[model samples]
Target: MQKKAGVGFYVFLVIFVFVIMFPFLWILLSSVKPLSELFGDQAFTWFTSNPTIQSYISVFTIRPFHLYLWNSLVVATVTTVYTVFVAAFAAYAIARLRFRGKAIILGVVLSVSMFPQIATISPIYIFLRNIGLTNSHLGLIIPYTTFALPLSIWLLVTFFRKIPFDLEESAKMDGASMMQTYFRIILPLAVPGIFTTAILVFIAAWNEFLFALVINTAEDYKTVPVGIGMFQGQYTIPWGEISAATVIVTIPLVIMVLLFQRRIVSGLTSGAVKE
Candidate 1:
């Protein structure tokens, strides 16, 4: 029975991986296919007789894809950094300190994160317009950070709670101030959690569509996701160019996940396992 179950699990895993990877594989293959072959009357197939780099070149030349890439990087990086830094303090307080309404506050934060961006877009748009922040990176960054904060705080708080309280008490005994202990002791120990939270925040900000679209309306400030969506050829959508753009944007994320898979796994599981 155990042998049969193990074989079943492997089969399931293989199917799951294929399902998850199929779209990405399609995008990747389509990106390299020539326009003639891509749009030919022949039924679409995985095989392409002629592949060209024209789609990739067009992605950059036809639109400000480079600028869009830069905007995504800047916005995602800044939002991740600021959100994680701020959430660190909030998470630390919730994890280590005894205070009134802490549970309520944490619950509210989680609840806020659960709200879809669609629900908040109208008010957010009005606020940005009123502040004259529309069409600017700062406009997008603010909302991105706001949305990312709850998850960041929740993850960090869970990780922080897992840390031994004895280290904190020892820091206090050694004449460290509260801030000093946080900076010197607790924060260092929570590096894994911080990194994991940062990556999640960065990815969220990177792929965010609605907030990026509504907040940054100008070509100069648009992110990759929005820019890619704009690949239209008057008559129809440019599938080849869109595929290329997707492949380009997806590569970075794949590389990041591969490079940090170990740390991400460790950080994610570390807090979940308690004695």
Candidate 2:
């Protein structure tokens, strides 16, 4: 009976993984297929006979896709850096220091994230326009950081709280200031968690569409998501080129996650058990 159950569980797991991975697999296959096969009878086929790299070449030559990629890299990198830095300080304070209304403050920070982007975009747009930040990378970065902070803070707070207070005490006895202890001892110990938070924040900022679309309408500042969205021509949609662009943009993120999967898992599971 147990053997049968185990076999069924494995089968279920395989199916689950396939379901999750199917869209990406489809997109990847579609990326290399020719335009004729894409819209022809092979539209729903699993594989193509005549695959071509023309779509990949066209994505760069026909449009400023490389520029869009560069824009996304810059904005996401900047947003991740700023968000993680700010969240670390804020999280460390909440985790280590005794303060009034800490729970309320954390709750408020989380509630800010719960607000729908559509609901807030109007005011945010107006504010950016007033400050002359619209159509700039900073405009997108600022809002991305704002939305990313609550989750980063929350994640970092858990990691910080799990850190041994004895370490901080020892640092204090050794003449370390609060900031010194944070930078030298606590932050180093929390590298896994910080790295995990950074990856998540970077992915969020990279794939963000609504803010990218509304804030930065210029070709120079458009990111990958915006660039992919604008792949339509006057007469027909460029599905082949869109697929190639997607494959290009997605490869980097997939590689990053695979490379750091161990650290991400470690960060998430580190403090789960009592020592």
Candidate 3:
């Protein structure tokens, strides 16, 4: 009976993995196939007789794709760094210190995080325009950090709460100031959670389309998603090139997940189990 159950579990796992991976596999396959084959009547064909790197090459030549890639990296990196920095202090305060209206503050943070981005777009646009920040990296970076903060704070707070208070008290007794302990003890112990949250922030900022599109009208400041949208031809869409660009854009995220899968899982599940 145990053997049969194990076999059943393996079958289910295979199906689940395939379901999740099929779309990416399809996109990767499509990216390599020549346009002649992609647009041909051989619809739904998984493999091609001939594969070419033309689409990948064209993705860069046809547009400022390198600039788009760079923009995404910079914006996402800055947003993640700022969000983590700010959220750390906020989380440490909320989780480790006794403060007034802590519950209220946390509730507000969560509620604000839940607010729809679409609903706030116009007001943000107006504010950025008024401040003369339109079509700039800082313009997007500020808002991305703002939008990413709530969730970062929430995650860090949970991880912080899971840490033993005795360690902090011990540090305090050793003539270490709050900032010193935070830097030496808390940050070190919370690396998993911090890295996990950073990855989430980076991915969110990288893939963000609406704000990137609305905030930066120029081709120079566009991110990969928005840049890929401009790959359209006169009459038909450039599926091959679009797929290639998508594959390129998605590779970094895939690499991040692969590299940090264990850290992410550990961080997410850290506070769930208590001694």
- Per-residue lDDT over 1-275 for candidate 1, one digit per residue giving the tens place of the 0 to 100 score: 34546788889999999999999999899988888777766328887877789999998988789999999999999999998989999999999998999999998998998888898889989999999999988899888866889978988988898899999999899999999999899989999889988887788888899998888888899999888876678886888889999999888878989999987776567546755
User: Which portions of model 1 show Cα errors greater than 4 Å?
Assistant: 1-12, 262-275
**How many times do residue backbones clash in model 1?**
0
Full-model lDDT for every candidate: 0.87, 0.87, 0.86
lDDT (C-alpha) at residue 61 in model 2: 92
Over 4 Å off, model 2? 1-5, 262-275
Alpha-carbon runs more than 4 Å astray in model 3: 1-5, 267-275
Compared with the true structure, model 3 gives a TM-score of: 0.91
110-228, model 2: which lDDT tens digit per residue? 79878788988998999999999998889999888668898788778888888999999999999999899989999999887898888877888989999999999998889999989
- Output the lDDT of residue 104, model 1: 98
TM-score leaderboard ranking: 3, 1, 2
